[model samples]
Target: MIKETFSKNTRINKKVCLTTDFVIAGGGLAGVCAAITAARAGTKVILVQDRPVLGGNASSEVRIWALGATSHMGNNNRWSREGGVIDEIMLENLKTNKDGNPLYFDAILLDKVSAEQNITLLLNTAAYQVNKSLDTKIDSIDAFCSQNSTHYTISAPLFCDATGDGLVGFNAGASFRIGAESREEFGELLASEDESNQILGHTLFFYSKKVDHAVTYKAPSFAYSHEEIGANPRSKNIHGHDSGVKFWWVEYGGIRDTIYETEEIKWELWKIVYGIWDYIKNSGQFEDVDNLTLEWVGTVPGKRESRRFNGEYMLKQQDVVEQTNFYDAISFGGWAIDIHPSEGIYSEKPACSQFHSKGVYQIPYRCFVSKDIDNLYFAGRNISATHMAYGSTRVMITCAHGGQAVGEAAAMCKDLSVSPKDLLEKELIHQLQQRLNRFGHGIPGVALDKSANKVSFANIFASSELVLKNYESCGDYVSLAQSAAQLIPLKKGNAPIVSINIIAERDTEIVCQLRTSEKPENYTPDIINKTISLPVHAGKQTIEFDFTDVDVIDQYGFVCFLANQYIQLEISTQLVSGTMSVFNKVHKAVSNSGRQEAPANSGIEEFEFWTPERRPKGQNLAVSFDPPLPAFSKDNVVNGHLRPWLNSNAWVSDYADTQPTLKITWQEKVELSEITLFFDTDYDHALETVLMQHPESEMPYCVKSYRIRTAEGKLLADVNNNYQTVNTLTLDSSITSQELIIELDHPSSDVPAALFEIQVR
Candidate 1:
């Protein structure tokens, strides 16, 4: 039994000694992800969040939208997202908090921590005191809960400092750098010419909502009008129409110590917020929104940079631009080498400067592990990165991924009874990458394991699936046949044909004639199933066709497009990503050399892709299936590729199906306890932008209601109204079965049923 003493300040005077495998400080997305990852790997963890809620900057008090590999869609990151735990959290946000309500977001973060059995979350607790051993290891951490003034002494084998400001790192006397380094230090073109402490400043934001009645405002004494603020380019972009993220330029305190002068900076920012609202509401400059009222304003400032710990490697700008392939890579960052003016909102020039990379660059495992301290590991904004590199890696989602990598590394350390650096030295890094892949994380050059499913892995490249396939350009398309026809691979037989997607330009009806290739060599449509005419529209849209009206029985491969002029197909570029095409005789492709593949189908009408130089890759239609198995070109579900749609991706069931059921079977009986399901929550949608009100929920094809059963027809687990992108279901008792059936009774939205991966492990 533990004894406690009450103090006059309503604090517990007793010494609370607790032990855990991993102790994580900070409650932001990064810290949250670290705790979640370690706990999920079968370890006891104590997560300390300084604030009353989780999600540090993303919390209700400081509402900065999370950004990462996608770079808020501004960096041209075609289908990239921070995979693994961050993907799970983001998808959950897309499903429930479509409006990006900070309050609901706070709940989501809290619920995730609470749902995990091994995580003991300490909200409103600050880890202020640290005890370091003489051997340069973190022995224990002391945290103070201000609400009750209770002190906790937590001892753990490993400590993760995810505190965005690196509080624990500083407290533990870790080697860290303060601000920008000279260009000579790293050879970064964008690096400051001289050594300086000019770091990215803290920012504050406010939300505005229009009320039914006219709303009025009373400006504070320090409020400054737009004209008075003068010469700030960010002012032009600031309007009632803009969301909070747009006001990231409302920042200050870069010249001062970020940790020491935070309060002073926040006070100045408060005046800016009220002043900006006064300009928008009181000043007659902008039109409309006379009834607009300030919904909420942040009291605490959202910090950008502070003390970055020194590790084995300090990532530089060239590494990102050149797409450096680090051997010890644990994660990848696609966000550009972004930099901001030190003067923040007051700067006369542009607020930010962004430079994109040809592709995502790797984040090495050495960056997070301490160079000197054996047990001290840190992630998030404080991880080892040059100031220029930190600009891109500091986004919340990227930090979250970093946290996950650090947490997983910590768990591995606990298991091996070795330090993080020693584990890497032991050449156990591949195990980490494999585990990251298994968790659905996309580490470039790392592929998902296909041996578990035993099914042959076949599909298009990663760049095939368009991120946002909407009423807009539903990704790119390529005419595989050039007589204006295309082919889609059929994954399995006896699977009823539900519908096929065709492209059109105008609101005219066109006939979609389906025909199976004869002799497995003729690429031309040999057996015509049925000619169904459907009305087509401008931009890319789907045209549905059913096979029940036709007579051909066995299995047929490929579908040809037949329409008058005006419709065009979209496909990926050939110079970078190569695609394969099927033609009747002489094959034509998107190529400069007029390159053609050996004729597989001979003696038929002309078949050509036209451009031989173009890779002819990821160029396919969004088709649907009944008794749905998987599409041939894009086998999102069955195929082992389980990251975002950046790679040719996704398994969609089309608009015709209301509820879809999936059945998984193996060659032999296997013990089954856990079932993981990754849903299609529409990666094409954007979330980190300055939202106008709360936007509509992302159109996700999630299984709203589901049930799991065994081969013996016994109900293993039944879940109704499921809303998770990564749905994990466990049975009461371990069952040995060769087959498992999943019935998706309802969908979260009006979209098709899609699954990234249904990992049996």
Candidate 2:
């Protein structure tokens, strides 16, 4: 047994040997993600949670959807690149639940940390005191648990305060600012003209759920009336469910006052919320939702503003709008300038429009480390930024990114035995970029110049690996079919030029052209390209002309090509018939077909087939299943134990039935790699098993052994095959030889048996 002593003033407890290299306070999205990231990088991490669970504001406690860089509620296009620990959590969530709702978010968070070998989670622990070295470096933190009234002293090389409230930073003697800044401070349009300590308000969200039966609820005694809220009619009566009412406009006081004191404000907001619901129910506005019942009422207020730590760098409003690319940027924010009134329940315009940035902007790593205290990093809304800037970066998604960056940086600091400020070196930044890239996090784009002999291209998007093709060229335009067009022009004086402007929505790619129209019969040595990869929003991009030596000019025309999605293209110049020729490499057909190859030797069976038993009528069901079969476990699998099993190539039988009728219900879902079918081929082959096999192209393929048996004492055909001779199966429905069968020789139950093997390809 371990004996511990406690100190009164500092709340220091008997030496509690810290097991983590970094202790991250506040289990909000930022803190949780940071812990996960650091732990994944082979760093021991301790994540302290004030609440019982993780995801502070966006958790079920506050009940808000986790938004991404895009404005859409569930939009994850931009976050695809923000993999690593965050991605692993999301992937796990997708595996268990497809809805992406709050019900499973906690599990996702827990699983992510719990699975990390180096992460220690201490929930219901709040950091209340700090011990620092003479030079103001964070030596240790004293966390207290209210339930047990026990204190824990945790010492770490690096510390991160992901607490949006900046609780740890405040206790550690770190300098921090709160409330709105003067216009002169950050030059933000929404900044208070006069220096004032006003800040954005907090909210307590309540949600309704639809049950099988009708139910109604009345307002609590603590609830207040609309008149008590004192907001304007427009402000108080905004649409709730439809417009997704966020009553942030109702706010009060700042860091100087305890937000707990504003219980009356929350009470008033609740009353207003219920009053609107009652009016809708009684006024007969919509009867369909009469069954709508209150599902949850957030206890932890969704705070939009809080203490801002003073760090090496303070992100200003000008930095955000100017799209300033910081040398030490650790994260990016795309949220708009969203601020709520501080005095009244509502204001004329709670959110300002003038200071809003047009696109995603960078936030530096220095903003995460405290200026006064060494070995301390801050994340989330507590980062070193003026109140106006925090208003925009306070969104949960942006905070998640911040958390990921800090987590990585903190881990790096421990490994190097240095502070976060010192680890912000060029080489360290490169390592961070590499780690983030592996997990799909976005880094600043590296601009590439056009080469004389090669048309090399690079990804110019914020943090994506997508590269550009056919960026510079001049040529005569020719139409491919009717929708696609190309231009082939010879090198001119200094630079041969062909410019094309295309407009497209996010994720849409179109075909482009650069060909010699002079050779209408044979457009040899022509270069046909495709449009640059568009982002999540609609935008336009220009391709300039750079021709060094080639000389060929012909009719230049443009045509839109058939693509996965529809997009409009407009050309400033019309196509004209002409003839000019120079030396150039012929453009070959670019086949995205490379991404759609058939699973090597693998077959898919019963892929997403649904029946009345699997899914009944009038009931919505989400289901996912993976076939059970042993494959060459050694080399076939990538990361997990069931590697070779994933190599099985399974295809759904088209003739079998695509959709399930009354007797058979099936929904054609996404394509699968492979599937397996179990059946009794004959008395001798009682347990006939079909192994849908696919080659593991990314890794070398291998096979262990094959087993076949029956319930009784009978041995089925047990044949061990090598990975070298694995047969390939095509997905084409016309070919019925897709299924490979394992036949048992005898009629004994043991003879006709299930087959298993480890297959590597």
Candidate 3:
């Protein structure tokens, strides 16, 4: 509710006092995402951001890529896109700003906030003062927006401090920690040996663009001379930059109080930004830069660390290394522990340290709520994490996930009239998980409760047999004499295999077979089902083997092939999971040099071969299946699985244009008010903006248009051109029907039509 208030000078001026369900501070991804989440759940929210635009560091002002599991494609995290608002923003960025303009992202963030009617956005409004009663509950927060010259006080039942520096929590006297912890504090290996006031400093980045004509540069008075730009290794790699955010190493002010000394830090960063560019343009150390000119430089420092709010669960470095699964897990983080030097660019030994996880790890809800402050919750870089663990969770997308969980928790609090800590109960936690799952947020170990699904057992789907696939790839692998043959693992399922094709590129004939693994733990082929010799004298050969009657053994099978003198494997990088590509390599004793096999001059036969390298998992192949069992199965949908099924989890269509239909027939007429569907939109298929730009389009094999029908062919509704993170249909009145049919439309992209999740409530 908005109200007009009067101060001592009541004649003219107006003071605004806004009452809301949740008052969120900071307009970064965490705060914005939290506001959106709560607003979507029908909660009144007031989101105050000090910056003129939203997205904080992600805005045009800071231009940091929204990094998360997709750390700009830096590591081996497969199928790592967190499926929620963040995924939507990522895909939207690809669709609109393919060039990755920082200016364009500002508009995206603005659109997201304005789309929700329940959200009141106060941009350029900084929340600085908080009022707490003797009971220690927050009463109101005082904020000032210079743009409108308005003195406002926002009061709410709940509040979140996503300020990156935990401004609201700090003002409220919440328990928090800053800088690195002593080694004795948490047994953290990365902790400083002795307590110290040091942290990862703020960095300033500059962008350069090339123009048609030659551009000249004269160094600014404050810019460092070439001699002053000394031997920092970052300068060595600074010439002829392409990306706008190349100089992340240009930083200062970690040794000082980062929050209090930001002005000094920004000045230092600006000097370095100018000095680096001056050295590039006028120092004569750069070449091919005649057309390059300075574009944009950050005026304010991009902060890396500040006040760390203490939450119920303090996530230490061991929690990261152990990959602990929390019972109340709300979000997951997979980025490496990237610890930067306190001195930043001036450090002689590399600028940053990194340690990667075996896979993604879970973060608990207890980590987002304050330990001392009763109603205090925070997200972004200030959440409950030790200094060492904060290095990984501080990234924007992971922080966005934390914001998402907070938003949902706030809504739950409103409904139950409980605090953030109260939701930790097993039942309430499960309720939160279910609500999040309904929105398709992937919780690490939580599966959607299947009892709520509309389909029980009667609905039957018959089309081309759907087969579950463990991998996806568009490339081919050919046999190599020196490297050994490719061994593709095929896991046994309920459905029998029809036929499989192998792409071979060799002029010489080779022997291949459907072999079983020596053991589940080992990759070596043990037993053979059928051995066949194929003539491979061509540019490319398609070898097919029918497995309609093959007997399986040990729950696994490998497609093993003999090699030729020279061969090349065609592999697809467009996929996430598929059959593993195996090869054997031999390395020298004292050196890093290695070979596929022993030299030909050796007396002993060069027969020693190892498994293939684990770089590329997706191998291109055509796998088919026959009629499936349990005519109508829960596996048809409602598995809480996000990825597409290769041979299972869906009903396959044998004939194109046949228009496959999946019908759910209940035991009796049931009331259906809502229906949700998840289709196979390839998350691994990223939109390229910088290197290669493709027109924003739907993923292949995605259902473009579809109709809802009953067993009697009664038309209910029709959906067209559906391209979203998920599809949900809600009706004004409940419909009683014994069956529900979803007629498939031909996919716009080349592939099969797929549905991952179908839920009706």
Candidate 4:
């Protein structure tokens, strides 16, 4: 506005130089989680993102829904949601935007990052250059923001490359692989026969809405014709009702270079999308799409695979498929080994080939540390893994979960003045896991350290504990169109005597099997301990199946009822915590076919899939247990576990206990500066980040109202409408109390009050 100045040589845009303890390049869910986790652990963090908004693919620009272990509840990993910062983010999104608007999710991420005082968020800044002080250590990162025309030079002792494409790691000359490795390379059964350049491609999504008036569309000249697309055998799936992520198969560029030809891939996707829309509008294939209009289309394609940087250890196919327990385990993943066709949408092959392990597998910390760059860490889809293993670890939420592990390692490294590799020492790794678990991060087979909690020394008691009894049938009957099973927790001994109400169309002999997982931690019903046949009458009647003679271990017993459409099982409204009913059903979206049909010699086992039904219909099957199963003990709160695993690792009060109370008494008056309470938010629920809508804003199992008090009944804190899994109460000052009391209210009339863990510091 004042004057225009011309430079004789070159004009330098606004330049900024900042220093932090940790620098994270990328603002995707992984980077966001890393930044948030590091910052929360008292580390200065700088987060750089090329996009104007955070949440990369999960942002509105791309609109890919966030998913992790739950895998749309299509697999056998029950209560397997990734914990830590990502869980908090997902829970927050569920509370405020259960409808899963991408914009709302974007805001939530931005809000969370911005709230962190120690985080310096640089949006629209792309990291293009890496400055190294040594051959094995990154010194600084050079990034530029096109929107502001500014350059940022950020230096940090630690750096996390979560850019998805491994931009920072690539520029830093970190060891990486660009394509699939041969089966012999890692001895992977799922790997290709030989090394190949072909990889998963980029995908774009579009959102359409129904309008009041009829809408017309004209296809662009570049758009493919209906006939051109019809040449593909899968074209029949194109429907007006299906848009956005539902058209995940409308992809391309796997045959080409996804990194360099992003624009080309995007154009092809656009053409495919437009061609699909045109086919629905004018081809007379869809009957009711006149009022439908495209609301939004992604500008950039959501990338699936690219350069995977090598870490100290490259995760291989067997690690995931075998549920390998690494010595330095830091995180876990449960998504299937999902590999896509190299030809993408044009291919005759299925969109994706997926194979699931029996249970969730641990991800070691070494996979997050760079093998070449000492100061560099990997996150998101770029983390070290072979092509076959990457197929499972590449999901957004899973990447975010591993990001948390590296983030905490970064913080600990700074505190100890050591590199990430040094933390691999047995004691140090345990400490790191302890720190992660303290912040609500879940690691398979790892429990919170009891020595760190003052409550571990105290005696705990509760007003009442829930005893498995009877689920009052709500008059809801589900036709046994498919085999169904109720997962019941049992101790080592005889199985419980169970009775179920079934309505039979005609007199028939119903077969019931008592099954359990081969592994105690898994939910897969792979072992059948007993099979019983009960003759039932035509009308509604209760049938008793006694398994008191059947020996069992401390695991979940799958009480299975074979498929018989002639019979209908009674459903109950009693939605208890940790207990669920699953069906051998197909969820076509996640490639679940009721059973996995792996080819012989594929190294993958064929097993039946028992997945829970989504709510509004996934009520528990009504059943009664003789000599009620002794579970949900109050002492479970001090058991060091945070979520439901082999059992309901929670202190769940009886449904009849209106004002559930827990007491912690100390031998001597102890000083407590802080008290942390872990609640049940139903970790089993998959809170999809976008597109999909959830039935409830808050988890029905969460303790909505609670009060903390001293022995004298002096209120310390009164919390209401609580919806989060973790609630930390930092007292104004250290309180000296010999006895503490916690009063809880049931989240709903039907749901009981449950608390997973309690810690005093």
Candidate 5:
């Protein structure tokens, strides 16, 4: 028997009360990651998802593929493990299914949360109201689900608002701001001279499939007319043609209100999309319309801007540009400034010209916890950030990293039974860094070494002479040698190493001498010289000079010279180069150290050792290198491709030309041992071929291959046949300096061949 209470004319349905150690609001990437992280850390977690599934923007509703920081396709890199729960879900999907579909995403998310013993998930739940104590702490939240006509009262020690909208914070009376701030506030260059409430617009993404034949579309009423839409003012008119076409450019509703206008803008965008398609088809743009169809229409709109909560520290544009490394950094972001215009329905090009920075910058922990609220943490776009700052950190992967940070912070709170503010101390930050490092999260930056008093140059070349130079004027000597060499700066705590890159045909001999201007009379053996011969063929040559033995004096400097040459150098003072060629040529002089950092300058001539020769009209020359390889046998291939119910498709191939060859340089003598062959999964209808070879060995050998496959006859793995479904093979370390060749068998016609990752370790 359930009782309903009527307050005046309103009726409220009562439900069971659930308690947990941590309660996370919003089921988006940030919330889900936070919940999973907290649960994994041995805390009882309650995850309240507003939707039926877990992933927010990346879910089936939005249908955006999960992308990490790495550029490798299909998981070839090891650095893509930022989201632990996301990776687990992907692994499960790859194991059980072969088709890359949206439905599988939902299933995986549900399975992951439901299977976890420490997490309790409540789907189809929306947080409508919050109850706080007199002390300004969140006590409980009241959630409503219309489908069941029920009200849920959730109580937890720590509350996390993973909602991109910062709904929980707004409702809890937490102070926040909207729109762009003036540049004077944060000393940011990208900030608008005048403050404006206008921000970036939201997007309703859709996917269209291309048919075998072309289709035509008819123009709609809202379609930009020739008179209405013309050349944009920001961009140059190329060949007297207007480049403004309504694609992702059509943006609006950021001025009046970011959240309230999102739905209206979404509806308008949908009309534009379908209406444009209709115009294209009917307007005789193409022929054959039978196969053209819409593949997916995003129900969840991608939001670009929203409320930003005030925190202990506000990340500004200056911090990003200056590459400020904070001691309390918890995450890193590398996306460039992607600002949008305020007036047009679609966004205009960014006003400021600069895009990327010197490198990736760090996000501090103080940005995660709120300044006014206690026991409340925020992640994702809702964190403390200026409008310009959010323009870069609002990407999905960056949000995931923020979510991971908050998740770990929540676990620490539960363990210490203290508020997030109390944990902002220095020692705890170091502990957080250590834990994150263990899980492959790179810290902002740390000094490795600092002393310059004991610097000595070793491994000097025999053909060069050493000369004494004024120690305090190292920069002057570096500028003089700009045409052929450059000196890299060392951080306050960094052990300095000098690297020379050969660029020209000259067999250049370089002499380096270290001296102190303060004590000219005291001559110390702190000098070294190196003369390296340029290779006959143009190629890069690297020479490293270790400075571990020199007795460096205060105000010491070093001088470098091109032996028997007198060439002037041109120097430039720019931190980074605009293009790849210039960037590779410009070396990072100073490491990230808290000291009198060197000025950004480039005076030395950048050297290169490799130069290509012009070939005759029709002549082609082929060059190859052969190195010692390893051997393989049956014992190494313990698991065959025909056993234990292989999950997906399997096959083999022996493409001698395509097979990966091994080039080994043995450092010491060793014995031979059995080799092991790893195989890829049969999931996603992927088939692979494996191969092995001894490379013309006369030793009497008995080779045997085994098959470990599923009961359904799908190939699992094979070692002796030199065929493996997996991407990596580990040869026994005992097999030293032996050349082994391996190949894969051709996959079946029905299955597509694919490989993800390979590693010898």
Candidate 6:
């Protein structure tokens, strides 16, 4: 290498210019997903990030666990995991890093983006300037990498602002708001009477290790003393077991300007973190922590609230609580309106206030497009939403879901020669939704477009379909300390009589209720159909709940058993594809109570939360129907719907069928080029990105091995050790066949084989 001597007055770094179809700023989950989606859709993409790694807040640097609609599986939104690219990332992470190592997650993201040949990733680069082709269109972006000492000029027709701070939009002169809107302005019941500048604060996390011997810790001069930390009521929540995201309340700087004073905010957070550690180590309030040593602390704070760019539509409080549907809906969110106090750790108020909707709500396409900037798109926490809605949409995986929508929209826009706004005025919005649903992005009320698929018009039949009959008791008994319910799919007419085995510690009267959701699509048990009381003795007995008089339409029936601490319910180890068990219990982490209480005029409905238990524990109650429910059918595999919503939308094989197979026939020979299979990956699981360990690496119901062949038994493709939900196979050459058959290996002896929609083209 040769050293250059600069004699001029000024010297600049090396400059590089690149042109692409789409440019994305920020390398957070949102940007990574957008870049990957666009790249897969045949668009040349240039993705830029200021950090050394891909994940932004979820990186090893920040270490915040990524959660979305499932909300750590602590609410009533059943089977509501953000799908598409984010779902893939989650499943991949589970396979290799179920322990939730942040560094491994970083590598997974890098691998996903790098695998896409159409994407050019720029690391340690920050977009600092925007060149506008018109008043509302961005021509190019100027970014610089401090590590390489080089400047890059990236030009593109479409630009997406995935930067958590809305950096690109800000540089392009986009309109944005920083604080809560007035209640009167948007008619939001959750908003304050008047507008306020107060916002949620930034938080930092620190990890600890329990060594074999005693470890001593000394506080720096900047660290606050125990007496100083004791001034806040939240300090009492600290314990010896507290670590990682469990200490999410170590926050500050919400009352000040979060953008301009970021450094100051970080410093204050540092002082609080060190002070909290000191208090834990030396205050003598915590026991058995003498062997605990601080392993690492975050260098940067994870920001919660920032500049929210204005879009064509601003999602308000009612849009979430009321579960409003939009004609231009593109994505969905189900997390509660989780707002933290402005005072943060120093506040006398509780750590957070969360209000959940009865079901998942849809987010419109207008929320992802800028109002004034024609070619600008918004993703991540900076999307168009009021303070109340932002509280739910700010989560990382939800942001990534929206990013996939934006990426597909950009690809479509490039093909159609139109702007993002054009999708709203035209019928193209339906096309966009269809594209998203086809790619495993689950929209609540939307179904896949089967007009072009050959399987939609063909005759589909399976070897055998599962008929609901019985889930025998596995001898695993759980105490009825809390109310529990079994969510079962039933046909229209008289509800089936369910028999549940229970052991009573003392004589008690058990109250059982049959219920269903007011909205047929939702899982919330708001409408009570029948109430029955069963008097039991001190011994084990099988109680029958006969709901013959309760008339019900096609929907989910909740067989609820109210809390009776003296009784223990028998549970079955067998996991049905379309069935689950939920409990009316409290999850303090997400601020969920057994029953939600709202003010008279708050407009938020009050309902009991019956959420599922995480796997290895959430066993369905052992129950048998007098007459088996006709829920699963062979035709469901070709039905358009991929995931469970109003119906199971999946064809499950009978338990006795060892070698399950599905056959599709056509009247005449048809040429097939591509075939896609959708398997059940248990969308109900939350799959948190970090700090939470999953019970299993692969979903129990997923098909591990499968084969595809023609009527003559000519093997076309054979796959073994498969774990993903969507598997697409392309023939080496077009093959003409009148009949196609798919054979699958059951994931486990107990868990039956299940398949969702299948597509043939």
Q: Which stretches of candidate 4 lie over 4 Å from their true place?
A: none
Compared with the true structure, all predictions reach lDDT values of: 0.67, 0.49, 0.69, 0.90, 0.49, 0.90
lDDT tens digits by residue: candidate 5, 1-761: 99866668765486867888988888877787777777877889888888888778667776554433221111111122232344334445544433445666677777777877999888888987888984568988888776687888888878988888888899899999998988677776667677788677765555555578754444556654332333334222211111111143444557657677777777766665454445434434345544565555566666768899998999988666555778889886655445777654433553322234433568899998988889899988789988877876776656777787788788888888888998789988776665543332444342111121011111111111111010111121122233222221111222233443333234544343322222221111123332233222233344444443444322212323333333222222211100000111121111111111222231111112110111111011110001100111121122121111111111222122233222211234323233333333211111100011111211011012333222233333464532222222333343332222333332322111222211121
Residues 1-761 of candidate 2 have per-residue lDDT tens digits of 98868756675344444655889999988898898888878888888898988888767666665554443311111111233355445434544544445657777677777888888888898888888875688788888776666678898878888888888888888998876778776566556677777776666655665778977656665554444433343443444343122443334344234354556656655665565555544445455766777666666667777688999888877776555778677777755455555643445543332123434578888888889987888988899888767866887767888889888887777777777778678777766655554343454341111231011111111111111122222222222122333322222222233445544455455543333322222222223332333232356554333232333332222211333344544321111111111111121111111121222321111111001100111111111101111111111111211100112111111111222111101122122232221111110000000011111211011222333222232333344432211222223332112112223222221111211211111
- Candidate 5 TM-score to native: 0.58
What tens digits encode model 3's per-residue C-alpha lDDT throughout 271-310?
7778888888777777888889998887767899999988
Provide the TM-score for each candidate, comma-separated. 0.74, 0.58, 0.82, 0.99, 0.58, 0.99
Off by over 4 Å in 5: 1-11, 65-100, 212-250, 285-290, 344-354, 446-761
Native-referenced Cα lDDT, model 1: 0.67
Model 2 gets an lDDT of 0.49
| Residue 547 C-alpha lDDT in model 1 | 59
Candidate 6 stretches greater than 4 Å from native: 1-3
Give Cα distance to truth, residue 568, candidate 1, Å. 9.7
Total clashes, candidate 3?
21
lDDT of 1 by residue, 90-162 (tens): 7678667766778888888899999999999888889998897765788899998888768899999899899
Error of model 6, residue 227, in angstroms: 1.7
Off by over 4 Å in 2: 1-19, 73-81, 211-216, 226-265, 282-289, 350-356, 446-761
Q: Write the per-residue lDDT of candidate 4 for residues 1-761, one digit (tens) a residue.
A: 68877869877899999999999999999999999999999999999999999998899999999999999999999999998899999999999999989999989999999999999999989999999878988999999999999999999999999999999999999989988999898898777789999799888898989989999989889888989877876797787788678888887888998888888989999998877878888888788899988888788898999999888899998999889988899999999999999888888888999999999999999999999998999999999999999999999999999998888999999999999889989999999999999878989999988888988899988999999898888998998989998888887778888899899999988889999999889999999999999888899898999899998887788999999989999989987778899999998877899989996677887888999998877889898998788778988888888987888888889988879999999999999899999988888899998889999999888998999999977899899988888899998989799999999998888788999999899
